[model samples]
Target: MAKAPVAGGYYPPVGFHFKVEFVGIGNDNDIRFQSVAGLTVEYDTESFKEGGENRFEHKLPLRTKYPDLSLKRGMLTDSKVIKWCLDALQNREFKPAQINVILLNEEHQPLKTWNVYNAWPKKWSVSDLNAQDNSIVIETLELSYNYFTVN
Candidate 1:
């Protein structure tokens, strides 16, 4: 019997290819984004020093802070995300939405997923347009979320 060659070590997935999904929001069916950024999680540490402690410091976890998430994409004609931000500004009604960021492998399969909970748009900005530059108009949406989990 002939022996087949063994496969080498595994390669890490690329970071550029990913998908974002918006859930628990009305009129979010057409919310296709180009890029998602600002996925960060951090913790605050508290240091305590005892009266008779030799030279060691006690470090404790104080609180966890999740930074605001930002999404960027080309400006669409419908502009559902812009509308949502306007609704929150004008009507003062902020609706929580679940945002999922999925990283896909080369075969287009989901490799990792991050679920953001209770997210609402905090700010929105549009890119500047210039006739000299031939670039598509891009829009950025910043979101403030309570917490997020990785799966």
Candidate 2:
């Protein structure tokens, strides 16, 4: 007999149930972000002409490049995360911090994790205020990192 197809796990974890943590900074609520983007690694390539080949040029990877990680959440009046970002952006006091983006299951257990290294805030901005439409003031934090490891 074959086992059941539906098991105790989900095929793909839900994106909305993830958490982002700025290591060694900020309180618990600072980890709650509406969205995390720019978890990307791209290998820069260079091409050169082959000595004898007529139709094709060989390409080689030069280096790996990572784009700035973007994090968005509801604006909070009191937040340590904001202080860190402000210190770097406003005061020019730069400090690197580790960042973790964890994908969670229904039970809140970590399904997968992306550990960002040497992360520092590159930009920060808040959504516009409007009297006509009601919406949460969203704050966005953009971070530049050296690299990331998945686990």
Candidate 3:
């Protein structure tokens, strides 16, 4: 995402300066995300043709479809967000929650926000272990959300 302009001709906030929150989860680890992806929506369209004309087909817009959301962070031994995801995926008990991705300025003030609604974990995975390469193990959590609002 490109940085948006700020007041007083201030430069745009860097992408690395941001915060993520899983609303009401009450976990410190939940807010520290290394990366967030898949905050996008596209309209589903249908094409219609008239019997009498040979012109281009009319395009009709349908409901909006949101792609799955992905959050990544360093591996943790314990996390409430992980437990919630496990309960839904492992125990077949699904519970949805809201997620907020906030882009912050130099002062850590929110420049823009994306509120994801009714998000439930769809897939969880950890990075591959390779002794040859030295890197922190990252855990990725994928979720399917109904929709997101930008502000």
Question: Highest lDDT, which number?
Answer: 2
User: What is candidate 2's lDDT per residue for 2-91, written digit by digit as tens?
Assistant: 545766653666789999988889898998999999999999999999888989999999999999999999999999999999999999
Runs in model 2 with CA error above 4 Å? 1-4, 7-10
Off by over 4 Å in 3: 1-10, 51-55
Highest TM-score: give the candidate number. Answer: 2
- Taken over the whole model, the C-alpha lDDT of each candidate is 0.81, 0.93, 0.91
- lDDT score, candidate 2, position 70: 96
lDDT tens string, model 1, 69-131?
A: 988888776756577777886788898788888898877788999999999989888899899
Q: Estimate the overall C-alpha local distance difference test score of candidate 3.
A: 0.91
lDDT of 1: 0.81
Evaluate residue 42 in candidate 1 and report its C-alpha lDDT on the 0 to 100 scale: 84
Q: Estimate the TM-score of every prediction.
A: 0.84, 0.92, 0.87
Instruction: List the candidates ranked by TM-score, beginning with the highest.
Output: 2, 3, 1
Global lDDT of model 2: 0.93
